[model samples]
Target chain A: MAAQKNNYRILTIVSLLLLLVFIGFAENHLDLYIVRILNVCAIYAILGMSMNLINGFTGLFSLGHAGFMAVGAYTTALLTIPPAIKAQIFYLAPLIKPLDQMNLPFPVALFVGGLLAAVVGGLIAAPTLRLKGDYLAIATLGFAEIIRVVFTNTQTITNGALGLKGIPALTNLWWSFGAAAFTLVVLLSLINSSYGRALKAIREDEIAAESMGIHLAKHKTLSFVIGAFFAGIGGGLLGNLLGTIDPKMFSFTFTFNILLIIVLGGMGSFSGSIISAFIVTIANEYLRFLDESIKVGMRSVVFSALLMFVVLFYRHGLMGANEFSWERLFGNKVYQKTLGRWTKRPRKGGYAG
Target chain B: MTLDLFLQHLSNGISLGSLYALIAIGYTMVYGVLRLINFAHGDIFMMATYFAFFGIVTFRIPWFITFPLVLVLTAALGMTVEAVAYRPIREAPKISILISAIGASFFLENLTIVLFGGVPKPFPAPTLFTDVVQVGTVAIQKLTFYIPIVTVLSLLALLYLINKTKTGMAMRAVSMDQETARVMGININHTIAFTFGLGSFLAAVGGIMWGMKFPQIQPLMGVIPGLKCFIAAVIGGIGNIGGAVIGGFILGIGEIMLVAFLPNLTGYRDAFAFVLLILILLSKPTGILGEKTAEKV
Candidate 1:
């Protein structure tokens, strides 16, 4: 067991080093298109991991990620847009005072954006956490729509339907990958902690967890707020990457896309989310031909079909709450025996001949 | 606001409310029987409109023939959807069923988008329904009068079907306790399918009237109205048909009043349903007419 722990530690370091080298290589040499896809994959990884934390780990079925993302994207976008550009974009309504003049560095803006989202999450969670199951889902979905509507009507602040453009492209591969890695580390550690066990306990049986003296509301709110924070950061990254954002972009469809990712990845598995994020993103891009020739919605049809298939046949998703570990890969006796059998079979046949 | 404008808004609200009532009945009935939200209820409503569109535009059928044909087709479509997407998971976890419903909803929407091309098509509104009737200072569409009458008639018919029929008894029994209902020799599958059929039929009627009023249809048009109707159903107490109608009227009138009085907030119209829903949910989760049922541990 000690040897296995050491192996895992070494594996973690090796993977981190490999990721760093890949980022360095991609930053300097990779084509713009490839880098953009990688950036999207990283952003989706952040989104998937955050969603998994709440829906998968905490057993909360909230569908308010889009609303949180909208808040974050708008905050970051409003903060980072040049004052001159802000004036131009808010042509319909004058830019609000103080906000028009305010600007911040990318990292600070992203952090503030996430913080604001977390605040919003907490506020929403206060009233909504009392509701359970599908009621919570619908309430959160309602909140998301309310956020979008508010954003659309508050033209002075969000530029309304006109949307914001010319957001500085500050979300490079390095930033996205860095944020994704940070989210993975934080969430993994949090999940392995006693607090995570409490969350899982709550998920398994809320009544029992409460009996055991776990503060259901407090832990549920914590997981929800943290999830919302990262979702906000991911949203900020996406907005910067796309260079524009509108209220329409943060609709339930966006939430459904992220839901599809987490569901396909295995609701509670961080590694599963990461893998499925890349697969779904790349598959979406590669499937453009189907849309171009047949119809514009073929991709969505395919995705919805895949979602149905997964829900119907593979409810546990790809990882089923399990993580990939080096110990399992190299230290399992059954695997070693199988490897030995395969290697020796051919030699045994030759000797018999 | 002047009484004249208020009357105009009132008539408009009633017309919209009746449509919501029609749609909400379907949601309520399905929820009553299956204890499922049937998220695809909206998409089913949308498909009804498209079916009507195709009946008139593609098949060149008269309004008299096309309307009934669309209703039957949509009812059949709803049953098929239930059989294909929902039947297999009838005994599964509620959440799994919900996911399947959502998936089915998305499938119908995206499939429509692919087949119909994403652009909005002008609905073929018959001249009879679209004509404006002047009432002194108030001008109302002919539909404003017809819709409420149709809604009342449908409600009466549904009530009669539920109260005075063998199938209704079966449905009630199944909803109360599926295991007991099965032991009593009720065909659970058939009853559920019939319930879906009834709900879809109402949705079809609502969809046709909605198309006449809006005069435009798109693949995604049903989403908002579907959600709003579901909210109406919830507010009225999800499983109660009469409550759904009342809830629908209240929502409709309240929404129109909000827009009429606060014209600046017209953009926030869609948000109204959600806010109302959240308030109702927080304050009274069982809804106005919903009875509290204890869950068995």
Candidate 2:
């Protein structure tokens, strides 16, 4: 037990050291464009975590993650973009006129935006949570599509499809890393807590969990709402980074992209999500040049090919039943052999544990 | 509004509703047998219309020649999808298959965009389909009338196929219990592929009719209809074929009525479907004709 604790401490310290080194390298050596890509990647890591919370951990199939993100982005944009400018572009006062006058700090605005999205998510969850599997997926997808349409048509606040612009640039490496780090820490803690165990129990077997005195509905709703909250914050960060916000940006395509990320990462694995989020973010950014060089749709063709190939062959994603750890690297061979056997065990009946 | 306007709206609603019902049949059939939501189903429908468009305009084929060919090809394509994309994953988790379905959908959609630019193509409506039918209060187009007629005929044909045939019996048996059906020596794979083919054929017919009615075709056009049909299938009870038709009609008519009667809520048309979905899922998730079963862990 003492040796295991020592291994964990060493692993955490090494990861922290690597994170600092990478951040410092990005800050000092890389150009602004590279830094921006890193920022987007960090934001996606947050979004992936949000999706993982409900989809990976709780076993809920939700295609409405983009809708929640839109709620966050629009909320942040409307609240922070000056009222006079909003009035001129939007041609109408928002339903919440009071929000227009208040321009809080970026972090506070983002938090509130995430909170509002959580509320909307809660409202959606109230009824839809009763659904399971594909029904839940379809319903959530509809809700996301509805949210997109609402944002597009509600010209009074969202500026319709024309998009919202001229928001204060609030995103930086610090905020991105901070939010991602905070999410990882909080979520890891929660998963280790009793609440997370109940969630896992529900995910594994809703009926069995119910019989075990776990309130299935309550846990599912909580996971969903909390996921939406972080998704909102991620959206806020994305909006600020992009320096423009449009309803079209939050369409089914966005949802699909994030879905691809979670699948490419091992769903339910935080470190996996974080790693793949960066990998995918960079791949997408760099691959834009491929599209420009060949044709506009070439990138999508490649992406689709990769997605299909992954689905067919690498069902477990890039991590593939393995979590990043120090035990495999420096531990004794017997330890390695036992760990290999344990990880090799089939992950049946539920998601990865 | 004048009586003429009201009648026009009603006719329009029915026309759209019938098209929705046609596509909803496909969703209901596949869901009934496999309990799999084929996300790529819409892409197949989209591809069929594109096939029809190119077959007529580019190949300079007669409508009579192209229509049947398009149906056959589309059905075959759907069967191929099941074979290539879905069959191997039959025993996998439903969610994995769903993601695979979605991946196939995206792949096909991107391929369409690559092949045909994102610009909407004007589908050459056959002259017979373009002729107007002048009712007393409303002047409905021939295609509008044709849509409902074809949908009803297809539904009747499907009902006959499923209810009055040996293959239908096998399908129903498999849908009830795959293991038992297999034990009984039913060819589950062939039945599922055939079910998909039949469903795709119906979707192709609907797609052609939709292209005629809307007079515009695009790679992404099927997304909305696909979603709406899914909603209809859910509303009518997912696995019940007749219920899907009813649900499609209700959703189509409901959207039109909302727009015509309550113009104030016109913007909420899409959201309205979602709201209805949430309501049905909460109040009666099994749908109007669906049976309840406990989900196994």
Candidate 3:
């Protein structure tokens, strides 16, 4: 146990050191264009983590994550924009007195933005969580689309999809890492908690969990709200990163991309999501050269074909129910087998705690 | 807006809704049977429109010959998709199939994009079909009339196929209980493939009609309509054929009405479907005609 504790500390330190070095290099060495892309990748990682919380760790199938992010982006944009500029931008309507006058600090705006998104996510969960399997996926997809439309139509609030610009650039490299770190810590704690156990139970077997007296609605809602909260923060970060906001930016494609990340990462594995998020973001950014010559929908064809291949042959995803750990990297065969056996053994079906 | 404008908008709404219903029927039917949301259905619909477009433009075929040919060919293509793309993973976990569906959807869209350039193609709308009819005070194009008629006829035909035919009976059997259907010697694979073919045929009809009505086709055009129709299917209680039609109409009309009433919210038109989707998902996941189903596991 002592050795294991020491090993974990060393791993954490090494990972943090690598991350700091990468960020330092990004900040100093890379040009603004590259930095911007890196920031976008970081934002996607944030969104991916938000999705990973519900879809991966909690075992929920949500396709509307982009909807919540849109909410966050719009909220942050609405809250942080200067009153004079907002009035100029949305000349057709009078601004909300509170929103116009108020411009909170960046962290506060992100927090409130996330909180608002979480509220919406919670409300959505109230009805959607009752659904199981594909129903939930469709429901969430609808919600995401609905959110986009709402932003587009609520011209008084969202500026009607012409998009909100002039958002405060408060998201630096440090801020993004801060949010990512906070999300990772919160998710880690939640996944290891009793609530986490209940969520896992619901994912594995809902009926069995209900039979064991676990309040299915409560735990599911908790996960949904938490996921939405982070997704919203990610959205806010994204808004600041881009320095522009539009409803079109948070479309079904946006949701689909993040969904791809969680699916490609082993579902329910935090480390898997982190790695896959980076992989997917980079692959999409760089791999456009492969099909750049193709006509309008051709790139989507190749991407989708890859997705089909993955689903057909590798349902387990890139990690295949494995977490990123030094032991696997260093070839600790005995520890890996033991960990594998632990995850595979089906527990007796009972109510979630 | 004057009464004529209102009527015109209403006509547009109905035409749009009818087309949506046509596409939604396919999605709802497949969802009913396989419990898989065929994401590729939208791409298939796009491909069908291209088939019709190519049949008319490339082959220089008349609408009379092209329309029927497109329907048959598209339906066959859909079945082929089922055979090639989805067949191997039928027994896999539902999530895997769902992912495969997404993949297939992307693959088709991208492949089409690569094959057909991204520039929106001006689909051939025969002048005869484009002729405006002044009915009472409202002036409407012939295609507007054709859209609703085609949608209704297809819906009737689909209803007949499902309710009054042996194949429909097999489809119902498979949807309700696949294991029981197989036990009863119903060919699960055949029925599923047939369901896809039938659905694709409807999608082709919608695609062709959409091309005629909008008269502009792009590879990505099917994405929004496909999503909206899926919402319609959900609202109509997925798997319920009649419900899919109703859902389609509601979605189509509601969107136009939203834009008409709140002209300022024209950009919010896409959001209307999504908002309705969330509302329906919240209040009635079973949809208007859908029965509630809980997994035994």
Q: Top model by lDDT, which number?
A: 1
Runs with alpha carbons beyond 4 Å of true place in candidate 1: A1-5, A328-353
Q: Summarize candidate 2's per-residue lDDT along B1-297 as a digit string, tens digits.
A: 898998788878898889888888899889988888989888889998999999999999999999999999999999998998889888877778888889888888888887788899999889899898788857789887778888888889888989999999998998899899999999999999999999999999988888888889998988878888888998999989989989988998888988999998887887887888878888998888888887666
DockQ of candidate model 2? 0.65
Task: Point out the worst 10-residue segment of candidate 1 chain B by lDDT.
Answer: B91-100
Q: Considering TM-score, where higher is better, how would the candidates rank from best to worst?
A: 1, 2, 3
lDDT order, best first, reads 1, 2, 3
| Alpha-carbon RMSD, each predicted model | 3.4, 4.7, 5.5
Interface RMSD values for all candidates: 1.1, 1.6, 2.3
Best by DockQ: 1
Which pairs, if any, clash in model 2?
none
- Tens digits of per-residue lDDT, candidate 3, B92-158, equal 8777777778777777776777788778999887888889989998888999998898888878887
Please report the interface RMSD of model 1 to 1 decimal: 1.1
Task: Say which docking band candidate 2 falls in.
Answer: medium
Please tell me which model should have the higher DockQ, number 1 or number 3. Answer: 1
Native interface contacts kept by each candidate, as a fraction: 0.72, 0.66, 0.87
For candidate 2 chain B, the 10 contiguous residues with the lowest summed lDDT are B137-146
Of 1 and 3, the candidate ranking higher by lDDT: 1
